[model samples]
Every structure is written in structure tokens, then in C-alpha cells.
Target: MKRFTLRTGIRWKITIAIAAVGALITLALSLVVHSAARVSMLESARETQLDRVQYISRNAEAGRKPPMGAKLNDPELPQELRDKARSGRRGTYVQEKPRGLPEVWAAVPLGNGQVLSLHSQFRESANMMRDLDRALAIGSLAVVIGGSALGVLIGGQISRRLRQAAAAAGKVALGDPDVRVRDAVGGVVRDETDDLARAVDAMADALQQRLEAERRVTADIAHELRTPVTGLLTAAELLPPGRPTELVRDRAQAMRVLVEDVLEVARLDSASERAELQDVALGEFVARRVSALMPEASVRIVADEIVSTDPRRLERILGNLLANAGRYGKPPVQVDVEGRVVRVRDHGPGFPEALLREGPSRFRTGSTDRAGVGHGLGLTIAEGQARVLGARLTFRNVAGPGGTDREGAAAGAVAVLWLPEHAPTTTGSFPVIGVP
Candidate 1:
């Protein structure tokens, strides 16, 4: 099964969160401001209307002409206000006018059977409220935008630190334990991200130390056993030809192979190991390798491109792969060469999940089906040798439940070795090491 994670970046997530909060706050403030402004403007207009109409009522009571804007029982005045005035109470009403300011009316009883009323459009208060609303809208928009930009700035800093730490961790996983996140980021733990970087750096340091110790131990043990295993093989060969003699020789040979593989693994781990490159016809090379290591395997050449590589190291890698196929996979192993890429496939139950997910691990057969055919160093040795050659090696299940299969072949595991197209500028030579 395959799994995936969301691709959205932390910057976008942070920006969205902050902008949403800012938008909500701005919306709330705008509501409160709009309501407060509307209420205050209406109240002020009502007070002005009431004062003018009352003054006009007093002037008409003395039989003086009212002001121009004031009227005596104007027909256009609201009937509700007129009725209230006739009943000896002051009344006020507001009428909405589309596309313009509101008309405010106030009526007062004159005590002479005539009602006095005054009205005017509240243009100044309306314009003030309109301007206030516009300002609030613009201010809200600005707050949201500014919040988003601030989030981006903050998120970018955090995301960059996290990405660096993650990349360093990935390099460590790929066997480069020297990568230190603290070097890329600051060493000081200023925040959570810095703390993470520090943790990654510490882990890399610890892993590097542990791996170096392990390599030293492995190399020492293998070198110590090499001479004894060689003597044991020689001693077994001198025995009389019998079943017991054959068994002794076979056991000694197995020990020698194991010791040699361990030593080879140690050499591959060293930084001093270098590839001696030369032009090699990939198709012909693969054919020879398959014949020598696994004669039952079939080879197909799609393109006979010449690749510059160390043939000895390439043979070691291919030998391990072929050995693994014969031991753990079913019959009809297939090797295909196309350009600089070589694929080795086997028709058997696909590789275990652990091997597929994490490549090969030392001393781990990865399946109960291994049946003790090897010491579980074949794939690991192959991978290390490939790395020394500056080549890429990948493992996958190309057939069966985990993958698609060839037209008539059963599901199985596939390992691909891809060599660089051209020779490296400098091919440093090291002592030739044989594969077990």
C-alpha cells in the first residue's frame, strides 16, 4: 500500500489562519461601528428636527410667519406625527429616501387647532455615516491583507528552518551522517524550529559516531578471520576425497565467502573507496555477468549503450543480485539492459514490505522464506558497491500484488542499477576487492 501527505505549505496554512481571524475581527468591528454610527446620526437628526418644529409652533402661536423650512400642517408630513401633535404631544418621524439622505419630520401642537411641523434631509449626518462606512470597509480590508503578509513573513522563516532540518535528516537516512542541520540554521535554540534543528544535528552526530564504530568492528573482525578461513580451506582440500571431506571443504568455503563479504562491505563503507572507470558495453557486460553468476537467468538487450564504470565493482553488484535472485526468488530470473540502466527481475513472491520500504538491511533476510541460503548480506553488499561506483541502485516489486507483472511472468521483485552516462573526470583507483 501507498500513502501520501497534504502538499500545502506551512506558509499558506499560516497565512490562511491569520487572515481568517483578522477577517472575523474586522467583520465584528464593522458591524459595531455601522450600528453605532447609524444610531448616533439618527438621534442627532431627531433632536434638530424637534427643536426647529417647536420654535415654529411658538411663532405661529403669536400669529407671526413661520420659517421657510417650517410649515403649518404640511400635507407631506407623516399622519402619525400629525395625529400625535393633535393629541397635544410632540411627535417625530423619519422617512427613508432612495439614493439620497433621509427626511426627518417633527410636529408640535400650536393650541390653535393648527399643527406645526418641520422637515429637512439629514445630508450632513448621512454623508458622515457614508464616509465612516467606507473607511471601515477599507480599514477591514487592509487589516486582513496586512495580517496575511505578516503571516507569510513569519511562516517563511519557520518553514525554511524546518525544511533545512528535514533535508538534513533525509541525508542522514541516506547514510550521510555528517549532515548537520545546525550548520544550515543557527545552532542556538531560539524557538521550536531551532530546537528541532539542534535535535537533528545531535542525532546526526550520534549516528556518525555509532556507524564509524560499527565499521571499525566489522573491518577488524573480518580481517582477523580472513587468514584463519584461508588456512581452513587449504587444510580441508588436503583431506581424502569423501562425503565428510566434501562437507568440511564446503563449510570452510562458506566461512571464507562470509569473511570476504564482510571485508568488502567494510571497504565500501570507507570514504577512500573509489571507482576505476572504463568504457563498458552494457549489454555484453550484463550477458557475461549473468552467465558467470546465474547461468539459468535470461538477458535481453534493448539498447547496447556503452557506459563508463568500474566493471569489477559492477560485477560484484550484479553477482550479489543474481545470487539473491537464485536463492530467494523463483525460476526464470530476467535481466534487461537498456542504455545505461540494467534491471534484474525474478518471478517469485515479491519482496517483503520492510525491504521494499527501507532497501536492504545487514543480517536481515526480510522473509521467513529465505531458508538459510545466505547470511543476508547480498543486497546490502550490492547496494554499498553500487554507491562506491557512483551509480544508483533501487529496489521494487514490479509484479504481483505490489506491482504490475510482465505479460506472462508472475509477480516478483526487481532491482535496477543505473550507471552514469559518461566517465567521471577523475577515477581514483583502489585495491581490487572480490565479491564472496
Candidate 2:
């Protein structure tokens, strides 16, 4: 259980707020009621004592003596009362805890040069005040406890609803277009939270629609250009074997590659790609793929763990990563496989800040020195392929050892692929990864 603090959570804040307000109101009411009751009880006791003193004085004038339970010449009489009686006027005084009783004393002057005093024990009124105090205390406590509990309930409901909407928004931000926030507190009780949920759902729907339209446009463009690209390739092949022909052939091949990448991206967007899973030793699979796709790169297998995955999709991901490293990074590109993780490190200027931050976009090359080097679709396709294989792809910059660089700057870029050991069985769809 966490201790409650103002900063702990919205629920605790709400609880404390309600408890504080309730306590203040209870305290105020208790003070008002207690003060009024104490004053009224004390006044009534004094009036009764005064009336008894007057009656006793009247009796003394008629030659009547003190009553059976009355005390004459009481030693506990206050001097103030005696002085008032000596002046031939009625007087009253209160003695707290006199003779084991809280008593109100009143006195009157007798015509025969004597004084008559009457006192009333206020024990019953004192007990009533004490009981009132106890009730007020108990009522204040109940108000605080009940108010706090109610605050927790209301705050928890609001927080839970907000969390649900936030989680759905997170999924949307991560490229999961199918996510929607459920109407937890449905119709007729709607408020701002419901409005926020509705807005988030609408935004996700709009994003999904826009992405679908873009995918359709890409697929259509790629489909329409395939025949023309094939014709260009064939025409270049028929040209005489010369420098001009080689140039034409190279350009044609480049165009073909770009078209293929665009088509693959469209398929990924449309969720048309499917994975074919198989059990394979992670170390061996990585070794084979690196040798075939990037024979020049160094390989180090620290652990051999078998993982259930799609081999072809895995190859596609690794191939693109290796190609990117070879084209843009410095020499000594290294591939390390340990357990279910595969990391490719290149001793080049680490990935550009923008590239690492915003991710790869088609045709936006990160290398300024080698401008127009290659289409930026390599990493984009690799990321999409990794997702299909139920793996995560991440990139970061790694710094070299101390004093290695003259300016002491970062060493290179590192791309990591985390493949889970046990892949869940999917029927016919490629599972979206790196998204919520």
C-alpha cells in the first residue's frame, strides 16, 4: 500500500481534498452548536439558582428559616457574592468542582443583617455538554471517512477512464490503426471524458482511412510502373555492350529496386504480408544470412538459442540492415548474435540525429557527404519486415573508448533486433510488432 500524498495520484488528492473540506465544515458546525448549547445550559442553571435565592430571601423576611437541603453561611461562597449581597442587591457566582459538583451560587440580603445563599449543582447540564461534544466528535469523524471513501471511488473511476483513452492514443501513435477506446460509461451519463474518448476514436479512424488510401495509391503506382520498368530493363539489355549501355542498365536496375521497395511498403501498410514460422537455431540462422547478404561483415555468435520465427522475413530484415551499414557506415561492421538478440554495429559516424529520432522515410537519405547514395527505404522496409516477424528493431549511437577520438565524439551507430524466443502461432496474418 502506498502512502497518500498530494502528489501521489489524482485519487489521493481528491480524497484529501474532500476530507479536508468535510473536516473544516464539521469543525465549524461543531463549534457553533457546542458554544450555543454550553451558553444556554449555563444561563438556565444561573436563572434557576437566582430564582431560588429570591424565594429564600422572601421566606427569611416572613420569618422562615433555610430549607432542609439548603446551606446557610456556606464557607464556599465567593467574596464577590458576599460583597454584592452586602450592597443589598442580588448576586450570582459559579464554582467549578466545588464539593464534587460544578455549582452555580446566587445570594440575596436578608432584612435581619444576615445573608442567604442558594447554589444549584450543574452536574446534569455538564454531562449533557460532554455528551454533545462526544456526538459532535463522532459525527465529524464519520463525515471525514465517508467523504474520503466517496472521493476515492469517484477519482478512481475518472482516472481509469483517462488511462484507457491514453492507452488507446498510445497505440495509435505507434501505428496501430485498429485500436479504439470503448465507451466505458455509456450514453446518458456522458461528460468531458467521454468527449475525449470519442475524439481519440475519431482520430484513429481518420488516420486508418488516410493510411489505407496512401497504400492504395502506392500499390496502384507500383503495379502500373512494373511493365514499363521491365520494358526498360529489356531494352537496356539489348543495347550494345558499351559505357552508355552500362549506365542505362544501372539506372534501370536502380529504378526497379525502388519500385520493389515501394510495393513492399504498400503490402505492409495494407497488412497483406503473412509470416511462415519455423524453428531455427538463432546463431546458425544469423550466420547464414550475414554470409549470404553481407560476406564482408564480421560475425560473432556468443549464444546459440533456437527461436520460432519466419526465416524469410528475418533474412529480409537483416539484409536491409547490413546493406544500410555497408553503404553509409565506416569499415569494421560487426554482427553479434547472443540469445535472441542480433545487433549490428558499424564504426561510422553514428546515425544522424534526425534519422534516429523520426525514423526512416522513403527517398530521404541521411548521409550528406554521400548524397543521393541510395533510397532510404532500406531501413523502413527492414523495420516493417521485423514487425511481421514479431521482433523489435531499435537504433542508437555508441561512443568509442575514452581518448580514442581526437575530439572525443561518438564512435558509431548500433542497430538492434530483438527476436522473442517463443513466437505465438498466427493463423494467416502477420502480427504487428513495435506497435502497441
lDDT of 2 at 185: 36
Residue by residue across 186-206, what tens digits does model 2's lDDT show? 445567888788887887788
Off by over 4 Å in 2: 1-7, 59-105, 112-124, 174-178, 183-188, 367-372, 401-408, 421-424, 427-436
TM-score of 1: 0.84
- The positional error of residue 283 in candidate 2, measured at the CA in angstroms, is 0.8
Model 1 lDDT per residue over 328-408, tens place: 888889999998899999887667677878888888887665435567788998998787776789988755543443332
* Model 1: ten consecutive residues of lowest lDDT: 401-410
Per-prediction TM-score to the true structure, in the order listed: 0.84, 0.84
- Poorest lDDT segment (10 consecutive residues) of candidate 2: 401-410
lDDT of 1: 0.83
- Cα displacement (angstroms), candidate 1, residue 374, comes to 1.1
